[model samples]
Target: MKNIWISCAGIHDTLRFTFHSQLKVMLTVMNRRKLLLAFLACPILAAAPAFSHEGHGVSHVKTSVTLRKRRGRTLHLIVTFLNQGRDAVMLETVAVENAQVLNAVKTAVPAGALVEAPVSLRFHDDVPGIFTLMLDFGEHGKGPVTVTL
Candidate 1:
């Protein structure tokens, strides 16, 4: 057997250079991750105010079925109109899908007040399933309010 000897010159310098390069790459990756997270959080922080505030918009009418009861083929409902805006609203028409609206809709809802009225809906056959009620607030807005019979 023969003995072999190897040189150890510049071994420490090579190891130090490799360690420093690896450390720099690790720090760069960590900084990039932090920057990405900060960018993602910017939009969420900006939209925080919108989520906290409720009903922050122009004059609009909100409708809901406060009371609902079924008797024979006539489904009686108490529709409540909430004027959340500054101006008053006049309910022009109230139409029920798959049913005939029997009551007249000429009620005036004052500003920031709630107005409830009796709405009688006559179905062709029988009161069945959920239905949608369409309301028209003249010059203000119009939308559909889902109601379950």
Candidate 2:
């Protein structure tokens, strides 16, 4: 009877070990399948376009302004322009209220390229709350960008 009981205990232990090993393998395979499904769904999930800047003959003009610290009461304004178009476009001038246009220079830009044109405007005494920077494109339409500081 003692021998029979010892044999039964050994069999139960072996069964438990086999069950745990098989459960572990099943879980690992399930996790791997989930990871593969997630990886394959990435391109389908990212099919939509984020932002579209489609311009006609008149190129799209985007501007951004940044203010710098100055010694005197004058305020330094730096303007950046990005050309989102296919052809080359030129900027005529930039206007600001109560501020003089210090310099207007065009940086190197390629065809169908986005470029940055920096313009510095300095205020002598009074600073305007709102100002406008008009960009002239000869054949294309003019883009008037407003800035408020």
Candidate 3:
């Protein structure tokens, strides 16, 4: 009877030690999981600016143009627009020489839309003069539209 009691007590001690060790391991694992979760959430919270600048429900317009001088008498112009407002917008591009309209291109952009159009301007090889490229955005003309020559 004495030996049996001693053996039972030893088994109880081993089980208690195992339970404590397992409890510590579980706590460590849970803590690591929480830290990883927090790290993953930070980038998602910081990405608001990328999503908010895409027109949204308001009218925000942006324009960019690239001009490349090609061989002979042709100039390639690539124009792009992003409408950030809730309303549709019309865009017109006019090439002016001494305030005189030489050539023009017109298009309409829907709300929250992006448009990239390429236009080619041909000038006579002997035409050596300064010209103005104007981007007119209807009544919203001067604002919201950018011109690159």
Candidate 4:
């Protein structure tokens, strides 16, 4: 066969052009993969925060009736509080149930803490059959739990 003649520089240029085209295609595929991954992860990234605590009206707050004392035309209640989460929780002063004394008392409870004493509450005149404790944990976290009558 007759010897084929080609310049060394011409060969190099053709190889370089092919390499650049392949590189460009690979880069485009990588960019598409990155965009797809980001799109798929959007929901998880915008997800609502998770709370360590779950029970009670709020995750961080837990309430119980330690003592219920009733007097003539008056009822006395002793409630307890506990925080099961790592962050502090704000407790509403007044409950959501009827016959509640709205004191608007707000208390910030530390995480992993418990109330030392029972909270004293009073009810005059008509006594409610059920007591509803409203809890606002913030971040769209709220609970309106009820105890016995």
Q: Give per-residue CA lDDT, model 3, range 36-145, as digits (tens).
A: 99899989989978866543432377777776555455666677778878778777655533333334467787887898766666665433444445566666554433
Q: Which candidate wins on lDDT?
A: 1
Question: In candidate 3, which residue pairs clash?
Answer: 58-85, 59-85, 60-84, 60-85
lDDT of 3: 0.62
Better of 1 and 4 by lDDT: 1
- Model 1, residue 106: what's the lDDT? 85
Go through the candidates in order and give each one's C-alpha lDDT. 0.76, 0.64, 0.62, 0.60
Query: Candidate 2: where are CA atoms >4 Å away?
Result: 1-59, 70-73, 107-111
- For candidate 2, give the lDDT of residue 94: 62
| Per-candidate TM-score against the hidden true structure | 0.56, 0.49, 0.43, 0.49
Deviating ranges (above 4 Å) for candidate 3: 1-59, 98-104, 123-132, 142-149
The Cα error of candidate 4 at residue 69, in Å, is 2.9
**What residue runs in model 4 are displaced by over 4 Å at the alpha carbon?**
1-57, 102-104, 116-125, 137-140
Ranking by TM-score: 1, 4, 2, 3
Alpha-carbon lDDT of model 2: 0.64
lDDT of 4 by residue, 92-132 (tens): 55455445553335666677777633344456556667677
Question: Cα-based RMSD of the predictions, in order?
Answer: 8.8, 11.8, 12.1, 10.3
Clashing pairs in 2: none
* C-alpha positional error of residue 111 in candidate 1 after TM-score superposition, expressed in Å: 0.8
Global lDDT of model 1: 0.76
